[model samples]
Target: MKRIILVAGATGNLGNKICKELIKRDADVKAIVRATTSLEKKETLTKMGVEVIEINLSNIDEVEAACLGVDCVISALAGLGDVVLDLQKSVLDGALKAGVPRFIPSDFCTNYNALVPGENRNFDLRRQFKTYLDGTAIKASSIFNGAFADILKYNTPILNLKDKSIGYWGEKADWKLDFTTMEDTAAFTADVALDQNAPRDLQIASFQISPNMIWTDVNTATGQEFRMQQLSNLEDFAQFIKKQRADHPAGENELYAKWQQAQYMYSMFSTQHARLDNLRYKDLDWTTSLEYIKSFVK
Candidate 1:
């Protein structure tokens, strides 16, 4: 029997990569996408012979229909609105209704229990969302990648390297930050999907790199000298951003907008201290190095 896998939010950057990687491995793929989303991804998925289904993940019945006969479901839903709950509800209801065996929730950052109640609203919601999944029969889990290695392209004021300056918590020295590239994460996810007896929560870490190391490596790779500046703590960093936003609310510079996204990054940097102990995936020999990330850097 051909195993069927459904990828929700399949048009997203990471989600689409997961679909393509799964297809590369010859697994039957069903990509669940919303009508409002671009079909450019749908076309690419179609070219790869994936079944692209246009379904509103907010609609439980419709999502259930999409999951029919699906052996595994992977969700990469973005945003922090109630849409998160809606998508989860839809996936859970649909999976149970369709008898899907496995589910990988839209969790790709932070260890689930690491969040302090008041720190990050988005991470808190995801932790709660994962708990909801635990109450169901469909085996489900999440991936805790420290941060997306690709996000370095954007120059957030806090961690802006484009200006020859990088800000981080603690001392100005190097500290390891575990990063997982989209491709490595997607490939590991495919491995998880293929393993019939794998545990509910499976973690796949590509690299534990530090900002100082990243800058040094980038400088060596591109022959461009850069500097890294360390900030005291997240609260101090938040205050700096708060003052910046207050002074220039409508600044044309993109870093102001990037600051909003940095909240998640800072939260990850603060709480991603857990030892990932993913010996289960050690046999796969899945590793992503700075050499692998060279193309992703700007």
Candidate 2:
């Protein structure tokens, strides 16, 4: 029998990709969306044969109703606040009430469990949610796929293709960073959700390369010599996080809060604390950094 999968945040970047993957697997897929979601997004999912249900995530009863008959629940919420917590909790509660056997939270980033509280506020939220899940009867699976490989294409501090430069937070350029494209992560997530024997926690990566290696790839792809920029030392990065926290405080400036969170995450990536489980998914053809860079840099 085909499993019924309910995906929250189905309109999001990762969520939508996961939905498409599940559809390709011929699973019975459903998406829980808000009434205010765009008509185009609703039509897009509808055309993909996904059952779209309009409901507010804040309403526990409505969320629970949506989870009825679902074999698994995949949440891809990409927000930073108490609302993310509340909505996901509602989904968990509903999934449990509906007797759904498996739950995958919106933990698609690095191994947040390895970091301490206050290192990154966004990661802390995920940590808190994991703690909550520990006390529940619902089986939970969290996927940590390092950083998204596609982030390099954007004008982030780390990779600036237009400026012909790659930046690092620490003096050491040899520190490895793991990355996985959202498309691959989503496809793997769908497989895991359907696999009854999959573990509760999984870590996967597309490529694990150093700053210098990334720069070399960019240079090779674009045919330009991209200079390396050392943005900050470890100490200075810590201080910057402290200053951003002091300047923004909690619930004051969302932009600064995100900036501080991003800096903290970059610092964590430099340390490479997360244990990757990429080998467990033997069938996945992971994208290499060079290939990914060449796809968009030129």
Candidate 3:
């Protein structure tokens, strides 16, 4: 029997990829899009044969109706705020009411379980939501996919390909940061959601290498040598967090929050708190950082 999968945030980067993967697997795919979504996006999804339903996620009734026949719910909602909490809660409620057997929350980051409370607001919000989900009857799965391969293209403080430099807080040479491409993460997520016996929590990493290894890949991919910058040492990182707290006392400033989150994430990567589940999903052909970087490298 073909499973009906309802994808929230289907118009988003990761969500759109998930929708495509679901379609490729012959699943009956439905996308719950907000009324504000662009017509062009909707048309594009329609062209891909996705059933798109426009509904305000804030309206419980509408959300519930959209989830009626869905066997599973996949959320790729962005941000780390109360709005995200409210929307996801609504989806959970709707799924519960509709008897959806599986739910995959929009937790496509590092293993937040390893981070301490009050350290990272974004991760804290996700962890709080997971705690709420645990108290419910709905079966929920969280995917911790380290860093996205696309981040290398961005000017993020973690890895800046444009600048040809990598940032670290501690012993950069010894710390191993894990990463997976957005495409691979979406594909793995679709497979997990479709599986009836997948675990409650899964971790996947296409590449787990040190900063030096990343530099090596960058050089090999682009045929150019790159440099490494130590953003913070152990003591310096602690002080950096302290200063961040001082700058954003309430932790409400989005920009400052992101900076602090990056620092905390860098620390997490250095410690290697999460276990990798890549071996379990042997069917997926994961994409490495070098392979993805080489695509655009001249």
Instruction: Score candidate 1 by lDDT.
Output: 0.72
Candidate 3 lDDT over residue span 1-298, tens digit each: 9999999999988999999999999999999998889999999889998999999887878888999988899999986565468889888888898888899998888787876676666778888889888999988888998877666667666667678777777666658877788888999999988988889989988778777887787788777887788876766676667676787666664634655665555545545635788877668998876887677655
Superposed model 2: Cα runs more than 4 Å off: 250-258, 273-275
RMSD in Å for candidate 2, one decimal? 2.0
The per-prediction CA RMSD against the true structure, in angstroms, equals 3.8, 2.0, 2.2
Badly placed stretches (over 4 Å) of model 3 are 248-261, 264-274
Worst lDDT run of 10 residues, candidate 3, spans: 264-273
lDDT of 3: 0.81
**Which order, best to worst by TM-score?**
2, 3, 1
**Which residue pairs come into collision in candidate 3?**
none
Candidate 2 lDDT, 1-298, residue by residue in tens: 9999999999988899999999999999999999999999999999999999999888888888999999999999877665457878888888888888999999888887766677777777788888898889988888988888877778676777677787887676777887899998998999988988888889888888888998888878867888898987877877777776677666343624655546545644545635776766677788898989889888
What C-alpha lDDT values do all the predictions have?
0.72, 0.82, 0.81
Top lDDT hit: 2
Residue 284 lDDT in candidate 1: 43
lDDT of 1 by residue, 1-298 (tens): 7778998877888888888888877899998887886668779879988899888777778888988888889888876545567667777788888889888888887665766664555666787787788888988757777677666666753346558666677663566776777877787777677667767665556777677777776776667767666667767876765565567655323322544465566665665545664566554454555575466555
